[model samples]
Target: MTEKMLQQYKVWDAPTRIFHWVNFTTVILLLLVGTLMYFKKDLGITGLEAKIAIKEIHVWIGYVFAINLSIRLLWGFIGNQYARWSNILPGKSFPAVLSSYIASIKSGEPQQFLGHNPLGRLAVTLMMLILITLAITGLVRAGTDIYYPPLGASFAAHIAAEGVDPASIKPYDKTGTNPEAYQELKAFKGPFGDIHIYVAYTLLAIILLHIIAVVRAEITEGGGLVSAMFSGRKTLAKKPEDLN
Candidate 1:
């Protein structure tokens, strides 16, 4: 075979590549919005209007994040081995692999794999669960209020007035008229709001660690691990004996 033909290999499928980048972008955006919401008080931004505007952006972006996560999860099951949930979780042979990895570490030798190693798999799984929880909590907090307001002048008029009398009333106008409903909305949002902030911080730490691990692998392994992830090709062994 020609050198180019011998070098041809496929690693990440198209769907997996798309999912990886999409999740990366959404995670970064979510972190930014979360930070703004968490530190809004300390930032000393004046007026309820500004605060509400920030929150609206945060909540809507959260909805988009949730949708992206759901699509990724579905793709994981239907995608390639590397992207599958089963690949991340330890299987029946995990004990032997774990032992080999531990022994290699103690002997100052490197363990290699085409897919995520044990520790990397664990981190990926944990990050996915945390993200899913954050998305669900955000949806639960927002969907209820957006679809059905508990108090205020009544979304009833806003719903009817949308096309009939656009200038007649506003959504917040209804909230202003119903103090009790507004308090109920606040009660639902407060606790989950705190949970979301803490989860975001945890995810940030995990992301930093993940990047560090990738950098270390690229430096030590000489295998172009990072580029392999994007290009779906790695340096092949020179001989069958070099295979591990």
Candidate 2:
């Protein structure tokens, strides 16, 4: 093979790699803490203590994820062409690109790209929305009763919908118990909390599928799919015709 033809490809920006791993670790940690809280198991403390600590950790991680997501969203607007949101959702071109990818996969031929493919882009977008909702709900739940008293009362009913009894906790007096506000908050909070949990589970499933797809591509396409995210290099085909 000619030297030029045998050369490998380089892709994936350093910032993107860092974001990927950081988000991965944060999600895993959140899952662990969430599981403990949902099950009400005494992970390492008494019943009440364990519940309190797990909830605290969950809230803190929610904040961390939210900040990281905001940074990523900003980066998407200003980053390289491959990283830009426009590249992923380029008007009507998105559907065509997505169809091409599906066709390539079915033909046992994977198309190489410098950045996320159409389906990948869509998945990332959905994941971001889900994470945002998760963070906002968690913040409202936390601030409602534990950290800030006045604000907590406003969202008391909403907080309770997430399986937390805002009234049971005596952190503040019932000085401004507006039943209407309480009921309104509760009505929204309850259904939103359930939706949040279900979406989290869906996110986990998507993550697993993403990992599997990467592994499959690496094996079949003879490309360093995983390492490319880390070291940003792909093995080149022996000849131009080999691209097929």
Candidate 3:
């Protein structure tokens, strides 16, 4: 067997690498806490205090995730060449990239990518959009249910305008003047929570598949997608023009 000679390239920049791992870690935490919050009753998590404590952690972590996602979305515009939005969105070369990937899969040959390959690029784009939806829905749900912040009080105002007296409503898990009003608030906030939970689950499934595909690429394509996110470098073939 012949050894493959590779040229080192600085593909992932420092900011991009940090954003990737922090987002990954935060998402995992969100999933765990979210599950606990969703099933705290069935999980034998008794008392309103215990549930509120769990909700507090989940809500704050969700805020951090939303902020992190915002920075990433902005960085996609101002970041390095490899991290640019244009690089990930289907550009003029995407068709060729996809065709090449398919060919490599069937022929057992490795294809090089200076940045995200076509399939990976598509996955990342979809994940980002989904993350934004989850974040927005989470905010509305938190506001309506617990009056957290940002949009929380705003949602409260809306419900208050609906003939439910403001003084009658209390944040969930707390004694309020009117239990019926709080139930109304919960019903108003229901759709946002539903969407957030559903989209979050979808994102989890996508993350698992993303991990699988990246691992497959690491073994077959020899691109350091995972390691490169940590070290900010990758190995690719030197072009013939550069060899001159």
Tens-digit per-residue lDDT, 115-230, candidate 2: 66556678777777777777666666666535433255555554343455656543233444555655565565576568768878888888888888778766765557688778
Off by over 4 Å in 2: 1-4, 41-46, 148-184, 238-244
TM value for model 1? 0.76
Which of candidates 1 and 2 is the stronger one according to lDDT?
2
lDDT of 1 at 153: 29
Tens-place lDDT per residue, model 1, 1-244, is 6352223235567776776777788789878876886688888976777766776777777766777788879877888777777777777977777687667656865676656766667778888989998986676555433432222224333333234442343434452234564456557667876787788889899999999988876675445667776787555322211133
Sequence-dependent TM-score of model 2: 0.77
- RMSD (Cα, Å) of model 1: 6.0
What's the TM-score of every candidate structure?
A: 0.76, 0.77, 0.87
RMSD of each: 6.0, 5.6, 3.4
Worst 10 residues of 2 by lDDT: 235-244
Candidate 3 lDDT over residue span 1-244, tens digit each = 8776778778888888888888898899999999988888899998877877888888899888888888888999999888889888877877887887778678876556778877888998899889989889988877776778877666555556355565555566334334565567667777877888899999999999999999988887775778889899887653311111
When 2 and 3 are scored with TM-score, the better candidate is 3
In candidate 1, stretches whose alpha carbon ends up further than 4 angstroms from where it belongs are 1-9, 144-185, 236-244
